[model samples]
Target: MMRGEGQELLNDVGCICEENGALDLLQVVVGKGDVYDGIWTELQKDHASLQAEIGYLLQNQQKFDVNLNVRHFGKVTKSTIQADGTLMDAAEKIFRGTIDFVRGSADSVGAETEQVLLLGDDVVNKTIPVILCAEENVQGSHGAAIGELDEETLFYFGARGMDRTQAENTIARAKLEAKIQKIGDADIEQKVKTQLAEVLDRDNR
Candidate 1:
């Protein structure tokens, strides 16, 4: 949690998967209030795999900077990184994801993807996805989807008698539902959901 105004928040993570080892990781970050967070994973032996997922929500001029790095140093290694984020009302966000395949890491596979939702004209979003390889037999890919809601999708809600404000609120809630479920504690999740509702309601006015 952020301590106070003008303070910074940062979290760094590192993991090593041994031979025949596997790891599945999930990360969630919410800022309202730099939140710099980084994760690094290394696969050092045969048949090692890593799966990483990250979710973030920022609003009200908040700022968040995050990065993920996955390194493959063994044969038949695999890694996948997925990131989902939402930014609203002058908020700023930057995300960088890299997958490195070292020599001798033949047959290794890696993919990274990012999805972002923009809800304000003043919001700023930047994403950099990189794949570095030193192995000819390895496979790697990266993709990003970032933008506001499409008109057709928004129309789907208007047809149901919802106004433009209502439509945006509904769409944002639907997207946030998935991340809300990622919250482990029931009480905390509910609290955040309630806070989100209040925020949206204020905007609706």
Candidate 2:
């Protein structure tokens, strides 16, 4: 939730040790101006697992830079990080995701992936995913997907009688739907949805 007229900087560091436990996190961000967000999650004990899902939308000439670090330190531990984003107007976003498998974390598994949808001509999107494994017995992987709408998809929207702009709005909103549905609180979810609709609708004008 980083939105304002002036630039914003946020650093959130979290370290937890889990034994036969799990942790899950979801982040949905809609912002203005320039923002730098850092999320750090580390330490997992034997049989522990961690999962993180992030969705961000930026418009106008705003810039959003986010960094996430996940570390595993226990045997048989598991972790996953997934991020999806959309950039409109001259906005830009930089996503840095890192997953580390430390020694003694044998048989650990770690994976990270990022996807970005681009809108407008001058928008910029960059993703840097790093995997560090100090244990040879662990498994780690990383990848990214970045692009615009394809003709086939566009046709699908048109068949449903949705104009280009309307179809795009639907697409943009869809990026965060997964995490939004997990909010559990009906009132808060509706408020967030209202805010997103207002922001996206305003940007369309």
Candidate 3:
């Protein structure tokens, strides 16, 4: 977890997977802040694998940049998920992800996905997902989706008597809530929800 307020926050992570080992990592960031995050993973033996997930919510003039690098030295698997949301003008984000399948990593599989939601026109979002293969039997894939709120969805909220700003806030909260819900700790989830409500209310003011 990280927070930024008119300043830059940087994070670097490294992981090594031994024979028959598996690693799972999750990173989450929130608020109107600037952030840079980088993660590197290396698979050292057969059957070693890694999974990583990152989530970000940026509002106001916040900015975030993320990089993920994975190298498969043996038969292994790598999977990554990145989700980001931007709610106001001047917010920007960039994501760069790469997976390398080496010669001995035959039969290895790598997959990556990135999703970004935008709520204002003045916000900027960019994503670059890459997979490099040095083995013929390896498989790699990546996908990305970026968009803003659709009119029909907003209209449905409007019919329920919620204004545009209210509806947008709801959507933004939902995006971050989805990530928090994955924590697998009921007590922690409730605590985070309480903090989130305070943050959201402050932002509205």
Q: Which one wins on TM-score?
A: 2
- Candidates' C-alpha lDDT: 0.81, 0.82, 0.77
Off by over 4 Å in 1: 1-7, 182-188, 191-205
Indicate whether candidate 1 or candidate 2 has the larger TM-score. Answer: 2
- Which candidate would rank higher by TM-score, 2 or 3? 2
Worst lDDT run of 10 residues, candidate 2, spans 2-11
Worst 10 residues of 3 by lDDT: 78-87
Give the TM-scores of the predictions, in the order they appear.
Answer: 0.87, 0.91, 0.90
List candidate 3 segments past 4 Å from native.
186-191, 202-205
Cα RMSD of all models vs. native, in order, equals 2.6, 1.8, 2.0
| Candidate 2: Cα lDDT at 97 | 87
Estimate, for each residue in 1-205, the C-alpha lDDT of model 3 and write its tens digit.
5453667788999988888888787766775468888888898788888878777667667778888898988875555555555446567888888989988998788888877878778888888888888899988988888887899999999999998878877987888888888888898778767766655674553
Model 2, span 1-205: residue lDDT tens: 6466566757575768579877787877875667777777666689888888888788888788888887888899988888888888788888888888888999989998888889878998888888898999999998888899888988999999998887778999998766688888898788778778876886443
Query: 1 or 3, which is superior by TM-score?
Result: 3
